[model samples]
Target chain A: EAGVTQSPTHLIKTRGQQATLRCSPISGHTSVYWYQQALGLGLQFLLWYDEGEERNRGNFPPRFSGRQFPNYSSELNVNALELEDSALYLCASSLGSGNVETQYFGPGTRLLVL
Target chain B: SQQGEEDPQALSIQEGENATMNCSYKTSINNLQWYRQNSGRGLVHLILIRSNEREKHSGRLRVTLDTSKKSSSLLITASRAADTASYFCATETWNTGNQFYFGTGTSLTVIP
Candidate 1:
């Protein structure tokens, strides 16, 4: 299987700018999750989309938003970026909801905000 | 609030040795999963232990989950240099939908 794939392996933006990151889940997977791994920190849950609906979100701000397409791919948009927004944004996919499956992750998009 | 907390923020061990990391969570969970991240890349699912299961093994990895204590431990036996990476424990909270809260992670460096 191809697992999961992400685009623009690395992104560079400045303060007040906006950056968009993309993620494509594995085939047959319905759930897409977004996480931010800041340097020296753990993976912080961002937003989750299951079956094209917003399922759950983490403690991030309003500017950090994303959507899941009909094809199960996702896009994360960070507007008015700040230097603190620099981190590795990861996307994960799973078979379905409930306790029956495990999440497979993408290589992630490294965003560097200056 | 983060659901899991891992210990020994970093670990370094020699090849052929055993590397163990611990995780503790706050709420009830449907299952707990362990993932490995090489460098700053995406996570690779290592193992999953359900709330009813005690221990599970895959290749050289052993995972033990204790529902009573709400804690889990991952042990890598006869480790190789390739096993070096950051390991994180994530929890799928009961009734919380599909969100999995992850801990900070343990950076393990296996020396050859």
Candidate 2:
């Protein structure tokens, strides 16, 4: 089975601009999660969407937001992007929003903010 | 705050040898998972140990959890060069709505 898929394998955006990254979950998966992997830092959870609803978010600012569509795909939007926003944004999917289920991840979108 | 914290930020070992990493968390969790990421790629789930469980094994990887101490450990035996990567521990809190909080990670280097 195909794993989670993400678009724009790599992106470059200028400071103060906005960036949109997309993700498509694996087949039959209902939960999509977004994370940011900054250099030298661990993966930080950004958002969680279950059944097309925003279930929770991380400590990131409001400028960082996203939504899941009816088909279980997701989009992460970073507004007023700063150079610190540069990182590899990953998307993962699970069978459900259960703490015990394994989460499969996508290749991720590398966002470079200048 | 990050739920997990890994020890020995980086490790270097020869191939065929064993590598071990440990993680500690603050809150109670339903389960804890270990993930591996090579270079700048996405993380791959390695193993998960439930709070009620003490240990689990997958191939060359073995995981152990100590709920009392709120910590876990990952052991990779007979390591290979391909096994070189950053290993992270993530925790799923009982009250976090299935969300996972990850650690800074342990960077392992297996030299041939």
Best candidate, TM-score: 2
Q: List candidate 2 segments past 4 Å from native.
A: none
Fnat across every predicted model, in order: 0.80, 0.84
Report the CA-based lDDT of candidate 2 relative to the real structure.
Answer: 0.94
Could you give candidate 1's per-residue lDDT for residues B13-112 as a string of tens digits?
A: 9999999999999998999999999989989989989889999999999999998999999999999999999999999887887889999999999999
lDDT of 2 by residue, A1-114 (tens): 889999999999999999999999999999999999999999899999999999999999999999999999999999999999999999999998765978899999999998
Fnat, model 2, is 0.84
lDDT at A82, model 2: 99
lDDT of 1 by residue, A1-114 (tens): 898999999999999999999999999999999999899899999999999999899899999999999999999999999999999999999986766578899999999998
> How would you encode candidate 2's per-residue C-alpha lDDT over B1-112 as one tens digit per residue?
7989999899999999999999999989989999999998988999999999999999999999999999999999999999999999999998787799999999999999
Lowest lDDT 10-mer window, candidate 1 chain B?
Answer: B92-101
